[model samples]
Target: MPHYFLDYQDSFHDLVDVDGRELDNDEHAATAARSMLAGRACLEILRGADAVISVRVRRGPTPLFSVTLAITEDRFHLNG
Candidate 1:
């Protein structure tokens, strides 16, 4: 097993995972990051606001990869 740090960031918040999680492999860590990102995005949408959510996967002090989800509304819409 390997230890992975998942740091989450959004429009209004920055959460650093001081206590990293021990997972089976890199693939599992990536999946967890994506799931977290999706859950955050859903919460933002429920609040009726656009959001830019990202999860940075890191091993120790080195960044392995990152996943981001951007949600924006279209402002240019035809009037009914």
Candidate 2:
């Protein structure tokens, strides 16, 4: 199986800090991460037939966060 990377903006960056409250607070970071992960999981399942997919969140140049899903196929074929 091939590996893929997903990049997205992080809205919780402000909430996550060295103070440890972000991790300790069940209603905050944990909840957000779970929701994001769940969405990614669903996408993976849907794309399983064609390719293996991975989802990741990353911060972009813009202020908003973007969610990226990468799909990698096992074989490569060039056809015009």
Top candidate, metric TM-score: 1
lDDT of 1 by residue, 1-80 (tens): 89999999999989999999998988999999999998888888888778889999998888888999888876787899
Give lDDT tens digits, candidate 2, residues 1-80. Answer: 21122232322222222222223332344344446656755665565544322223222222222333444447688999
C-alpha lDDT of residue 2 in model 1? 91
The CA lDDT at 1 in model 1 is 82
Which residue pairs in candidate 2 collide? 8-57, 8-58, 8-66, 9-58, 9-65, 9-66
Report the Cα lDDT for candidate 2: 0.37
Task: Record all residue pairs in model 1 with backbone atoms less than 3 Å apart, i.e. clashing.
Answer: none
Using all chains and alpha carbons, the TM-scores for the candidates as numbered come to 0.89, 0.31
